[model samples]
Target chain A: MDIRKQFGANVRKHRQATGLSQEQFALQHDIDRTYVSGIERGKRNPTIVIVNKFAKALDVSIADLFDGCD
Target chain B: MDIRKQFGANVRKHRQATGLSQEQFALQHDIDRTYVSGIERGKRNPTIVIVNKFAKALDVSIADLFDGCD
Candidate 1:
């Protein structure tokens, strides 16, 4: 399986589940909307630093990010 | 506790556990020795890209990177 694509789908699913727009999620993580978009589109692979930031912003664990992506 | 420090210690511990020097680990991950050194010193926050590479090279899961650091 393509982890990046799976990860992107997971990101999109979680973002929608939280009722947050890409821009809102980005702001919550102190990142740019484009960055979030890039990740969701599998155009960029985030670093662990950014991943941790997402975990915190989403009030989820790192493992949660992989939910449904496996 | 500082996650950066904990991560650094974890990185160092795993490297030693595998009997790999920083340079060896770097080569395994296709990263530079200085980059690994910076991470081990908590001076650099690796992106998920590098983390995944390390996970693959170490023959471990991402969760393993957190072992003994929590």
Candidate 2:
């Protein structure tokens, strides 16, 4: 699988685990809802800074977001 | 220090530990050296795909790149 897609899947898993809708997640994290949607769909390439935002918003470590993808 | 700066410092630390110059590292990873420099300097926001490239190139995990940076 493409790494980006794997990453996106991981993100989706964790995001869903948090029980927030995509729009709610983005608004709570101060990220654009469309950007969040794009990332969840693996159509967007989110930067490390943005990755940090996701991690922070999700309350997970960067590694945690990537767990078991390999 | 800002988290981004901390992230940059961590990248520099791991990159240097590989004993490759920034240019060499970037070339080996197919990343632009200028982009690597910007990332190391906390001046660029690299996507998770790029971050994965850096982690793969540096022989580290995404978590490892962010160790002790909280």
Individual DockQ of the candidates? 0.34, 0.58
Q: Which residue pairs in candidate 2 collide?
A: A47-B46, A47-B47, A48-B46
Cα-based TM-score, every candidate: 0.78, 0.83
Candidate 2 Cα errors over 4 Å, as ranges: none
Please state the CAPRI-style docking class of candidate 2: medium
TM-score of 1: 0.78
lDDT of 2 by residue, B1-70 (tens): 6667777888999999999999998888888899889889988777777777777888888888777654
Best by DockQ: 2
**Model 2 Cα lDDT, one tens digit per residue, A1-70:** 6666777888899999999999888888788888888887888887777777787888888777667544
| Position A51, candidate 2: lDDT | 74
In order, the candidates keep a fraction of the true contacts of 0.31, 0.62
Tell me the TM-score of model 2: 0.83
Q: How far is candidate 2 from the true structure (C-alpha RMSD, Å)?
A: 2.1
Q: How many clashes does each candidate structure show, in the order listed?
A: 4, 3
lDDT of candidate 2?
0.80
